[model samples]
Target: MTSITIDLSDSQFRKLQDFARVHGIAIEVLLKASLEDWLNLQKGDFVNTADYVLMKNAELYRRLA
Candidate 1:
C-alpha cells in the first residue's frame, strides 16, 4: 500500500480521532472506510432507478407526451 499525506483543520482532525476512538479502530481504518463510501457515492451506486419509476405519478407521465 502507498502512503499519503493530507491536511485537515484542527476541528476535523479532532472529530476523526474521536470517531476512531469510539469505534475502537485506528484512524486510518476510519479514513479508508470514509474514502470508500465517498468513492462509491461518486460512482452513483446508491441510486435506485426502479424506485424512481414507482415514485413517478401516472399523470406526469401522461403530460410528458
Candidate 2:
C-alpha cells in the first residue's frame, strides 16, 4: 500500500480518533472505509430517490392549494 500524509484540524482529528475507538477499528481502517463510502456516494450509491418523490408530491399539493 502507498503512504500519504494529510493535515487535519485538532477537532477533526480528535473526532476521527474517537470514532475509530468507539467502533473498535484502527484509524487506518476507519479512514479507508470512510473514503470508500464517500467515493460510493459520488457514484450515486446513496441516492435519495424517496426524497425526490416526496418533493414532487409537495409541489403537487402546492399547485392544488
Candidate 3:
C-alpha cells in the first residue's frame, strides 16, 4: 500500500479526529474509506448523467424552486 500525507487545518483535523473517535475507528481508516467512496463516485457514468440532466433541466428546476 502507498502512504500519503495531507495538510489539514487544526480545526479540520480536530473534526476528523472527533468523528473517528465517535465512530470507534482510527483516523486513518475513516480517511481511507472516505477517499475510496469519493473515488468510486468519480469512476461511474452516473455522475456525468446526473450533471447532464441537471444542466438540461436547470430552468425548469429554477422555476419549481
Identify the candidate with maximal lDDT: 3
Clashing residue pair totals per candidate (backbone < 3 A)? 0, 0, 0
TM-score ranking, best first = 3, 1, 2
lDDT of candidates 1 onward, in order: 0.85, 0.87, 0.94
Compose the digit string of candidate 3's lDDT tens values, residues 1-65: 78888899999999999999999999999999999998888876688988999999999999999
Candidate 3 has an lDDT of 0.94
In candidate 1, which residue ranges exceed 4 Å CA deviation? Answer: 45-65
Of 1 and 3, the candidate ranking higher by lDDT: 3
List the pairs of residues colliding in candidate 2.
none
Estimate the overall C-alpha local distance difference test score of candidate 1. 0.85
- Candidate with better TM-score, 1 vs 3: 3
Encode model 2's per-residue lDDT on 1-65: one tens digit a residue.
78899999999999999999999999999999989899988767336676677687997888889
| TM-score for candidate 1, residues paired by index | 0.61
* Candidate 3, run of 10 with poorest lDDT: 38-47
Q: Tens digits of per-residue lDDT for model 1 on 1-65?
A: 88899999999999999999999999999999989989988666436655577567667878886
